[model samples]
Target chain A: MGVIIAKSLNEACVVLAENPATTVLAGGTDLMVQANRGMQSMDSVLDLSRILELKEWTLKDSEIVLGAGISYTDLAEPQIATVVPALAQAARTVGSPQIRNAGTLGGNLATASPAGDTIPVLVAMDAVLQLKSSSGNREVAITDFITGVKSNALQAGEIIQSITMPVFQGPQEFLKVGTRNAMVISVVSLALVTDYLGRKLRVGVGSVSPVPFRATEAEEFISQEFDWEKNSSLSEKVINKFSDMVADSTKPIDDHRGTADYRKHAVGILAKRALERVCANGES
Target chain B: MTSEIYTLTVNGNDYQILDGHPSESLLWVLRERLELSGSKNACEEGECGSCTVLLDGEIVCSCLVLAASAVGREIVTIEGLGSGNEISDVQQAFVDAGAVQCGFCTPGLLVAIDQLLNTNPDPDDLTVREAISGNLCRCTGYGRILEAVRIASNSRTVQNEEEKGK
Candidate 1:
């Protein structure tokens, strides 16, 4: 097999343009596992781990721009954690310390695993994914980026450039229920981000859907019912209603990890827990 | 497909491997080609941390790293943790605490504990448990391993203090 160690984003783009079918290797937390399991066989690989540009991140105009190569360990940094605590919280739940050291957010997005721990957080934050090809650059919403389970909207020769998300206001919470506490794939995950100033809340659900999706109806309901100034606490009635709406939005499939019914119940529980946590933190 | 020459900086020494494949994992190259079997290959999948090694001073599962991609990077296996015929403090602590049983997970646990101590010298019980969460020991039930890491941290702190006094 042919391998090219890409040193820069531009060089990697050139390689991808020339070899559109080449597998893009990031941290290899997933790809290498498939290779070892005899599940994946590749003729050529475009190694983007060494690309400095992809590993760097910048925050401008209140929107955080994270390079695709930024590892989970990097996402757990104090700087990133401060800006997007939910994303950092989601990143912290990804695998073990060793896996976090190598596994990257870009790899997670590219893999497009419905159970990807961070995908729900990205969706809740309304992350915009940037894809670059020889032709040009295009931006797609995180919800649109993931077309199906383990399938994405990335075209041939196009690589994930960076992910940009506006810094969320108010409190944000990400909760994942898995088989184990660490190094476990999420059975059902929920991310809740409340915009107190905007009087809106965003809810993103994962694992129970073909692709991670936002509970738009739930969000609308929460935004209208949640009295930020009047209500001292999250009402149980509101929590139950919000959870039901979030659960209703998901189309979970029964797999070996969990059943659809269980996922629906778990999603409601997670959504309620996340919303409760966010409410407990007080405003802003 | 033809094999290519891959050079890795292992334990501060450079070794040139003539039969490295892109499909081959770093764990395979380390154990088979370099004969560094300290890092066990319990699970080729990243689910198990038995093949844990330090890549550029950060612990990562060697099984998840491509041999071809490891070129020019620094890698330290379990064998690199100790000097000639002398075990590391963490290893000694494991012995003292009876953390070793079947010993299949010892090497990876030691590497993970060492890295954890290097970054956090005084980790609490929860920190130690979280640090070694990836490593699985079917025999010890994690009680002795946690004690071993605590002992290692205590000894290391004392040593550092003594050095400061000297």
Candidate 2:
């Protein structure tokens, strides 16, 4: 059987409560491909695209709450672009205008693809995942949200309502090395958010592991030993420990995109380049 | 399965259609149900912009768009470009610029370029490149494809002046 279109979130929850055998469709960045290949085994689907309530990006104090169904096209507007340029850059990097128009942050989190463009950026910016069920709502840090590959802390009958994050310090850099530029998935992607400056320098890396991660060790190393202005031996220290630390944190494999070694090398290059940019930013 | 009827406005005309499910993709509805073959189904996964169409004054891949979700939205396909006889300035520019090679990805390209020129009448080369980065044409080197955008934008200017003269 096909799916039923739930006009509202309440109706969708009722559908989930009664018949939990439904797959929820937001942006079909991941779902449509799975459905075409007959991988998604749900007998029914709850189409949340029609639910207007699930599509808003608003500001609550310092937090920018992007609705579960908001498309990159919606976020590409000039006003929305100012929220977070790096996040916007991540959104623009998705695939193309069509992919951006169709994909959702909700689907990205739900699918939990390691190469999910926005995930690393969110991780760097200390974003939160807001999941809502028929019973109530709950929020989890993005770091604690994903448990494993394609497995998350989400319980049954729960759907990601929106993703919330404070508008972090800017001039942030988000870079990914892919096969091509626009459409191809990343070999490795890195997001550097200097929200704290001397307070903290958060670095998020994706496609190098089962889950995108912030290199806490590397962050500590930079904070303690390094100064961007003076003569820096920390570059050598960072390069020395970065490869192993980044590789140790990741669980990459030989996929059609690349091999584990290539991923490791990419991770190292990404790290050095990212910190180099940070240093450059500091210089500026 | 329960079906939902939605009023879809295509180009300028409005048509009511039955959707097997409200969540069904508009690409399938447009290609299979409505028989609008202008947009090809290259990568039904929304990677290739072969299925690109303008949805409610913006560009989107029809493959990833839900059929029932498109209700009450204005859709502009390549077929909607010109009046009755003459092709649109952008479409003509594509032809004049020799942008088409295999012609498979042309319709989506035309739609994409048409939308880009509407927003940025005089765009730089980089802007033109970024705007249509969604629509991929593997045949043409994309040099000529971008040239067509510039050509089309120039055509819009000349046509405006001609009308002003009358």
Candidate 3:
């Protein structure tokens, strides 16, 4: 077993190109846990912690590009929270202070867990991932990046560089239901993002599916029903209908955390509450 | 399975890990190789904060950190929090508040509370609760632990006031 600590992106890419099978270690929040349990083989590892470029985030005009190495603690900072409140909200609900300090956004994406708190928020925001290899770089939409449970579309020799998302000037909310209040994996999570400039409302649902996914049906329904310009209140009937659509979009399973029926029911309630909070013009 | 050699800077001291494996956790290296067992190993996973340590001054689960990956970074374990023969203010507060039960979770909690007080000396009850939410204690139902944090925060405030008066 060998550990190759790369101080730069170019160096890491070269190593990956030479050995595509080398396990990439960012924060090691997930990888190390697996290694401790004998579930992961650390025969060869490309440590990306020394790469400073991956730890910095840039706020471009009307867009935010976050480095994959940006820790959850950094994500909850005032600068990031101001621009992407849902992402920060989700980041706060992550494991713990220790986990938040060590876990990186890129690590969450690379792990590709369906229950990842940040994945649904990224999906709702229409984020895109920049993947790089020694050969070249490519961009993949967040929705397409996560292929399935604990799986991603990252090609061999490629590393996630950064995530880019447009800055929406609207209320965005993320809600997660876990077994306990803290340090528990999400039984079902939801993100609701309103894009006033685009005249669109996007909903992302997680944990209740093989992949965190955007609820296009529910989003479309809410976009058409809600009065965006007036910021009018949504009636109970409309909210219930929208919530049902969000619930209908999930593919939850019966696991230890929760039952499929319960997940479906809970996600709908989350959707209803989120809609009420975001749309009711401060009534909720 | 080959052993590797690496240097880890812990608590202002550099130690050479001669028998370190690439996959070994910082927690393992700290307890076994360096013999700094102050950072407990309750959960090898990140769920429990027993293995919490300061990596580059930020709290992180040592169990979730790769030993080799932590190269060239400053690490502060529970053992490193105080000066010679003198327990830190947080440690003293824990004793005063009777927060140490079974003593298994004390080391990690002390490290966490010390970090919290360093950053926010006057944290509110909610902030204190949030700060120690990661460090779970089955004993005392957390009332004494909360009291310990309050006591530490109050003492720090008093110390600051005294220095100001000087």
Ranking by TM-score: 3, 1, 2
| Tens-digit lDDT string for candidate 3 (B81-126) | 7799898899999889999989888888888889999999999998
Each prediction's TM-score against the native?
0.98, 0.89, 0.98
Off by over 4 Å in 2: A1-8, A41-43, A60-62, A76-83, A226-244, B2-7, B18-24, B160-166
Residue range B1-166, candidate 1, lDDT tens digits: 5577768899999999886666889999999999999999988888779999999999999999988888789899999987999999999999999999999999999999999999999999888889888887889899999999889999999999999999
- Please state the error at residue B105 of candidate 1 in Å: 0.5
What local lDDT score does residue A50 receive in model 1, on the 0 to 100 scale? 95
The numbered model that scores best in lDDT is 3
Summarize candidate 2's per-residue lDDT along A24-122 as a digit string, tens digits: 788777877765555664356677877887787898676798888888777666766777776777887888876777787787888888888888989
Query: Residue B161 lDDT in model 3?
Result: 100
State each model's TM-score restricted to chain B: 0.97, 0.91, 0.97
lDDT tens digits by residue: candidate 1, A106-170: 99999999999889989988899999988899999998999998999999999898999988678
Pairs of residues at least 3 apart in sequence or in different chains that clash in candidate 3: none
Q: Which model is ahead, 1 or 2, in terms of TM-score?
A: 1
Q: Give lDDT for model 1.
A: 0.89
Among the numbered candidates, top DockQ falls to 3
